[model samples]
Target: MRKLVMVSMLIGLGVLPACTRTTNTMGYIVDEVLVAEVKPGIDNRASVEKALGKPSIAGQWDDKTWYYVSRNTKQTAFLMPKPTEQSIIAVSFDAKGNVASVNRRGLEQVANVDPVNDKTPTLGRETGVLEDLFGNIGRFGSAGSAGGPPQ
Candidate 1:
């Protein structure tokens, strides 16, 4: 019995190291994030794309301009830490396709708009997992529970 226990312990010990994601916790640091420098009125669309690849998002609101963004991330397991890093590079241009202004923002520098409270968080609403399991499936989504109501 002792030998069996020892073998199991050894196996468990070997498996324990695999549980972590092997990511650096320091990646969560805000300032450690790398953001590309933008040269005003010099970097154009082609140059921007060559340096930063494709952006996570791109658009224009008022005038003609192009934007590029990039994000990098690292994560860990358990209580260690959740590490994430990202950067957004904005390349704007005039109608003439000349670089206008560059707006670089870090995750910390961006403001949390609270989603404009568009879908206001329900007060005292049924948030229980079990409740949704049996609630209306057509109107409300399936409660995502075992033995939930039939489709």
Candidate 2:
């Protein structure tokens, strides 16, 4: 009975860490109730800011667009986190600063961006290890020989 209990305890301890799920949330936290209060063509930037606080990102070139991005990811143990939910609230303003459009998107709109794997092509020729070590040896002549004698 003692051995059985010890084995069970050990198994439980091993499984506990594996079963743990860690959830990570980034960017804005949206509330449907607050979002409903915003009305396009009426709510200006100030009102929008007041209602939604601040956006996660603004347009790079101009301030006409605002983005409120949110993502929820979960990971078990040492596994890479996977996005379980994603939300993006895009609000655009016209020249007058009034909200022109309010759009919302979900995980379906998320794009998988695969970064380029190839290294950048440099202009210079690649030198080998030995060339790098001994390349500069004879360039400057002997170390002691200076312009005339040392002062």
On TM-score, the leading prediction is 2
Model 1: colliding residue pairs: 55-69, 132-143
> Compared with the true structure, what per-residue lDDT tens digits does model 2 show for residues 32-114?
88888889878999999999989999999999999999999999989878899999999999999999999999999877866
Clashes of 2: 0
Per-residue alpha-carbon lDDT of candidate 1 for residues 100-138, written as tens digits (9 for 90 to 100) = 887766567444455555786666855678667956655
Misplaced by over 4 Å in model 1 are: 24-38, 60-65, 77-81, 109-151
By lDDT, the best candidate is 2
Worst 10 residues of 2 by lDDT: 142-151
Clashing pairs in 2: none
Q: Model 1: how large is the Cα RMSD against the reference?
A: 11.0
| TM-score, per-candidate, Cα-based | 0.49, 0.68
Distance from true location, Cα of 25 in model 2, Å? 1.9
Q: Write down the worst ten-residue block by lDDT for model 1.
A: 25-34
